[model samples]
Target: MSTEERLIESARALLWERGYTGTSPKAIQQRAGAGQGSMYHHFSGKPDLALAAIRRTAEEMRAEAEEQFSAPGTAVDRIGAYLRRERDVLRGCPIGRLTQDPDVMADPVLRAPVDETLAWLRGRLAEVLEEGCERGELVGAPDPRAVAATIVATLQGGYVLARAADSVQPFEQAVAGLLDFLAARVPTDHE
Candidate 1:
């Protein structure tokens, strides 16, 4: 990879491990196997490099979500597919983890990608919920936005639970429980 590419990938890895507050330009430089001058040539500083890495992570996650959302099936099926998508349960949500880092949350420019990415995802899930209602698959007056928020929270919290327990079972159980509820609550017409 090019020096810039290497730097960004290294940033992603480091950010995932150490978060915004814990990572530094020098550390990133060392991890990338690039010199300080080279890193500076490509990025203004640590924050700038972090912005690129965060944006990349958001895009990657959004793409995966879209893949599941686009599949042929009811909203529940699509969402279930997404909930069950392969994940490193113990690693937690990369973007969500940033929210815990003071530095990341403090920087407006740095937080934009993370905020927008999550907002877009919640909106997309809400759209799916609305579609399900329209198709009569879900028979309830549920607020799509609220349901979407709950769904995302469940997944995000699932990761946290898994990481805390040092096991994937909690994550799997959380998703399974959420999916089961969503499936069981299938709206009935004229109820």
Candidate 2:
């Protein structure tokens, strides 16, 4: 990869593994096998490079979600697919992790992509739920927007629970509980 690409990728990985405060420009340079000159030449500074990395990670997250959202299935099925998709559960979410970093959250430029990505996920999920309700699949379902928010919360919370316990069971149980809640809302005739 080019020096620029390497730098961005290294930053992305470091930012996920360590928080913004913990990932220094020197560490990123070392990981990328690029020198100080290369890093500065390609980007203005750490924040600039971090913005690029965060944006790339956010974009990847959206694309992955879209894959499940657009799949041929009912809304619940699609959502379940997303929840159960293979992930580095122990490592936690790349974008979600950024939310915990004070440095990232404090910087509007660094935080914008994180905020936008989450908002987009919630909105997209709400759209799917609304579609299901309109189709008579999700009978008597709660408000789509609220439910979408709940789903996002549950998923993020699940990550926290799993990480705290150092086990994936909590995450699995959390997801299963959510799936059950959603399934209960489905019309009996459709089940």
Candidate 3:
């Protein structure tokens, strides 16, 4: 990869591993195998590079979610696929973890992508739930927006629970519980 690409990627990894407050430009340069000159030549400073990394991570996350959302299946099926998709559960979410970083949350510029990505996920899920209701697949379902928020909370909270226990079972159980809830709402005629 080019020096710029290396720098951005290194920053991404470091930011996920270490929060904005912990990731130093020197550490990013060292991780990228780029010198100080190379880093500065390619970007203004740490914040600029970090923004690029954060945006890339957010974009990738959206694309991955869209894959499930656009797949040929019922809304619940699609959502189930997303929730069950393989992930590095112990490592926690790249974007969600950033929300815990005081520095990231304190800066509007740094927080924009994280906030936007989550809102987008919630909105997209709500749209899927609404579609299911319109199609008569999700019988007697709650409000789509509320359900969407619950789903997001469950997933994010699942990550925290998994990390806290140093096990993936909590995350798996949370997802399973959510799936069971949604399954119960599926109309028997549709099933």
Q: List CA RMSD, all candidates.
A: 2.1, 0.7, 0.6
Across residues 1-191, which tens digit of lDDT does each residue of candidate 2 receive?
99999999999999999989999999999999999999999999999999999999999999999999999889999999999999998899999999999999999999999999999999999999998999887987889999999999999999999999999999999999999999999988995
Q: In model 1, state the lDDT of residue 144.
A: 86
lDDT of 3 by residue, 1-191 (tens): 99999999999999999989999999999999999999999899989999999999999999999999989999999999999999999999999999999999999999999999999999999999999989888988899999999999999999999999999999999999999999999988797
The Cα RMSD in angstroms, rounded to one decimal, for candidate 2 relative to the true structure is: 0.7
Give each model a TM-score: 0.95, 0.98, 0.98
- By TM-score, the better pick of 1 and 2 is 2
Please write out the lDDT profile of model 1 over residues 69-181, one tens digit for every residue.
99999888999999999987788898988888888888999999999998998999999989988888886546989989988998889889889999999989989888887
Backbone clash tally (model 3): 0
Q: For model 2, what is the error of residue 81's alpha carbon versus the real structure, in angstroms, after optimal superposition?
A: 0.6
Segments in model 2 whose C-alpha atoms lie over 4 Å from true places: none
Better of 1 and 3 by TM-score: 3
Question: Between prediction 1 and prediction 3, which has the larger lDDT?
Answer: 3
For residue 91, give model 3's deviation from the true position in Å: 0.5
Stretches of candidate 3 exceeding 4 Å from the true structure = none
Off by over 4 Å in 1: 187-191
